[model samples]
Target: MHVVAIYNNKGGEGKSTVTVGIAEFLAANRNKKVLVVDLDAQASSSCALLGRQSLNAAIREGRTVVDLAAQLKQTRRPSIDPEQFLVWRAASEARGSALESMAMLVPDGDRMYDVESSMVWGKHNHLFRDWLKPKLTEFDFVLIDLPANVTKSAMVCVNGLAMSDFVLIPTRSTHISLNGLPRTFSLIDQVRNVNGDGFPTVLGFLLNATDKRNQQYRSIVRPMVAASTDGEIPPFFQNHWPASPALEAATDEDRDARTLKERFGNAYDHARKVARELEVACEKYERTQVQPIKLSLWQRLGLA
Candidate 1:
């Protein structure tokens, strides 16, 4: 499976929206089986995919990431049932029966905060990675909606990056969001230094909520992102998500399921284009065989 982490260090950068959009497009249009692991304590992706009522049900039934982490904290072995944790047909997108293959690991922010606070990273890191890998083998793509404040939830963020094949940074076309790219890159570098070859390579930035009329996006934010990377422009997707009422409205989910066309409306084309770019980006990494971290027998047996 191609494990992709939709991440940005700064909040309100449309990470969850991008995660749900790309995941739905892949599963609904590209005929790919997707598993969205909601790593954000906010659980925004979980709610967007399953709707609020379903997400609340999952949280109540202990079918959240918090449950998985709490279980892992008490066990050295993979005792938790992965299938039980997954919510099938999670996206509720009525498109060609492909969304039927989509699933998610819902999250509860309140419980997640407690779990993160209690987590002993050194002890749980590899165990969490080993446990999650096998559960995700059935998927074509595993998209993790990572938390914004990585410092506040360092344990989960570190292991999430460790398990990912690519890290796709989603940023808004603004000063605050674009300026945070350097810090995000620094954190990725630190993770690479810690995990070495196992760390995920940057999959480039997906500029969200772009306004074609605004030249500032091109004139200002573009240069800022380039400067952050030491004068070399980062790989930005050619197709950006345009600012639109339809796109903004699509981010909010209700009890009703909607087709991609119905939900995204005119912004459907924008989503499709960005999703296509994402697919093309993954192909290069796959050909190069950017391997995710695999547990050795010693590590699996808790010897390493």
Candidate 2:
């Protein structure tokens, strides 16, 4: 199985949304058994993909990622197996067509932040990596939705990402969002140096929620990007997500997967194209012993 982390260093980048969207696309279009691990404390992806009812039930049962992280934080005792917490048939009945083969590790709202703060460097950093690494061969794809900042939860993602085959950074084309790219790469560099497997090779900067008709993006941002030194940012995907409510609404309102497929329409096509790109990247990474790129951004940011 191929594992990919959809991550970034800043908030409001739609990482969770992209995670769910691409996951559904892979499950439906590619017929892949996808496991989405909600690594963020916010639990946004959990609410989106599994809905509040399911999440609440899971939390009550103490079968969420937050609970799992808490159990792992207990360094003295034997590590509890979080495999029992996997939520099967997570999507609503309406979404069965596209999500039937999909499984999720939901997060708890109350203890999530606590789980983040409880993390120490060694004991909890590899909690997620150690737990999920064994299941890689069971699922066709394991997609992780990481928290958007440099918190302890984010470090778990960074640690887990090092073990992944690919990592995809999702963001908008705006100045504030693009500004996070450099720090994101720098964090990757730190993980590469410290983490055993080195950094997860980035798939690309996925420019989601972009407007093709907007001249501002085409005239201003695209040129700056073209002229800029983007060796640290990795390559841009050929297909990108357009600004639209349908993408979030379908999941937010708990629409069935079939209806979601109808709502996204051509957007699903775009998602499929991006998934194909990821497929190729995963294959190439596994085939070659490519070394992780030590980005110069860490030096520029005075982080190295």
Top-lDDT structure, candidate number = 1
* Candidate 2 lDDT, 1-304, residue by residue in tens: 8888898888978888888787877777677888888877688888777777887898898888777666765655445554678887644356434444578888776576666665766555565566547645778888988887764345456556665767788888776777677777766666655565654667777888888669757764574345334554366776788877677574564654454466466576777687777777777766333244444543443334
Q: What is the lDDT of residue 206 in candidate 1?
A: 87
Candidate 1 CA-lDDT value: 0.74
**In model 2, what is the error at residue 66, expressed in angstroms?**
1.8
The global C-alpha lDDT for each of the candidates, from Candidate 1 onward, is: 0.74, 0.69
Clashing pairs in 2: 94-256, 95-257
Those runs of model 1 whose alpha carbons end farther than 4 Å from true positions after fitting are: 90-101, 224-233, 255-257, 287-304
- Which TM-score value belongs to model 1? 0.86
Q: Cα miss at 290, model 1 (Å)?
A: 10
Give the runs in model 2 whose Cα sits over 4 Å from its true position: 75-82, 90-98, 152-155, 223-232, 256-260, 287-304
Q: For residues 1-304, what per-residue lDDT tens digits would candidate 1 score against the true structure?
A: 7888888888888888899889888988887888898888777777777778888888889888788877877775767778888887644435543344578988787777787777755555555567877767888889999887786246766677767878899888876666676667666666665565645777878888887468868675655445436524346777899878777776677624467776677988999889878988888766342223222422432223
TM-score of 2: 0.84
Q: How far is 151's C-alpha from truth in model 1 (Å)?
A: 0.9
Judged by whole-model lDDT over C-alpha atoms, candidate 2 comes out at: 0.69
